[model samples]
Target: MAAHFPINHHLRPLYRLLSALAGLYMLVFGVVGFVQTSGAEFFTRDEAEWVLGLRTNPAFSLLSLVAGVVVLGANLIGRNVAHHINQLAGVVLTVVGMFSLAVMQTEANVLAFSMVNVIVTFILAAVTGIASLYDRVGSLTAARAEEAHRHSARVA
Candidate 1:
């Protein structure tokens, strides 16, 4: 009585949806930044580049858009792929946010964003990243439990 191929436990669809939404937000944010500003400079935090008080530049916007696309695309591929994508994005964004905070007043950040903006990014990163990781671990544990149950039943 070996355990069946079907894995009963898995991450909820919400995690996948959240990841997709994050990506869409980045893509739209980039497009909106472009539309809102006339100067297509490679990098600037001028008032014109402000979207809801968060500064954005061509490079920043492009990067966000790319990240979003990657996340969304991963979700389309499969649950495992999506989980990995969220995990990767989480680590990157968390680091980026912390870096931004460290260099908030410095000129090192060409993609300088307001402190509030940076904080928001960190929150998003943490939420999606942690949730996906939790879901993945839970699913794995459930699968293992099911396998153990099946093994014990056959032994009995």
Candidate 2:
């Protein structure tokens, strides 16, 4: 079998922890959304009922819960997969945030997205995505250097 790179870098554990925390935040927010809205609507723009400044409804809250579960799961799936998960989330979230910004004023946004939502989402996406990308690249580089050093030592 071909050699596989292990996620042994210092940042791996930190990344996992961050992901878990983010997941927890999402789960909590989702639950709060449900409690506050009383299941009266699937989507709403009533900022008065906003959770953390983002318009939410039953569907949106559910989506948050689902996302939380997935992120938490990713953290437990080992380093390699976790790195990829971060990357994927970064791209997806960034796109979603930008899209939400674009449609924030329109009634088509089912999530009742607003400026606060867009800003926060973008921050999350950028930070997670960039950090993951950096970690992956640095880890791989270090691994490669170590491998080369070992190979040269063995040949010598």
Candidate 3:
């Protein structure tokens, strides 16, 4: 599996920038949601409360803030740490999205997740996962050799 992933990919900077942007978006969304849902029950499932076009509650807002900070911090850290964090966040977000989807209409929707929230979660997950794939750090020599190997393998 490690062999299948590229090392020191040329597009790493772009992916990192995208990931950082996603984190920033999340941070802003969380803050706005937190402010909008203030004084409401932490886990209230009120559909009337929305932020950035997505339903939210205090609990969800707090969670989003934490997640955003973690992602942003990882991106700033860069290298293997960012890669690992992005991968983990992707999996976690996917699971959260799936769970939210499953409980969308029921009373268990503590997050007050709307359909759009699920869609956004999946999109963010994909972005973070893709970013992780190309965020590896390595020597240029090793990268060149690995690229050559991959090229040869493709031709064969």
| Candidate that would win on lDDT | 3
lDDT of each: 0.70, 0.70, 0.88
Error of 2 at 87 (Å): 1.2
Better of 1 and 2 by lDDT: 1
- The sequence of per-residue lDDT tens digits that candidate 3 reaches over residues 1-156 is 345568888898899889988888889989999998899999998643878878889999889999999998899989888899999989999999999999999989989898999999999999998899899888889888878878874433
Writing each residue's lDDT as its tens digit, candidate 1 over 55-76 gives 8877777777787778778766
Root-mean-square deviation per candidate = 6.3, 5.9, 2.1
TM-score per candidate, chains pooled: 0.76, 0.75, 0.90
Task: Output the worst ten-in-a-row residue range by lDDT, candidate 1.
Answer: 1-10
Q: What order do candidates take by lDDT, descending?
A: 3, 1, 2
CA shift of 53, model 3, Å? 1.4
- Model 3: weakest 10-residue lDDT segment is 147-156
Which is superior by lDDT, 1 or 3?
3
The clash tally of candidate 3 reads 0
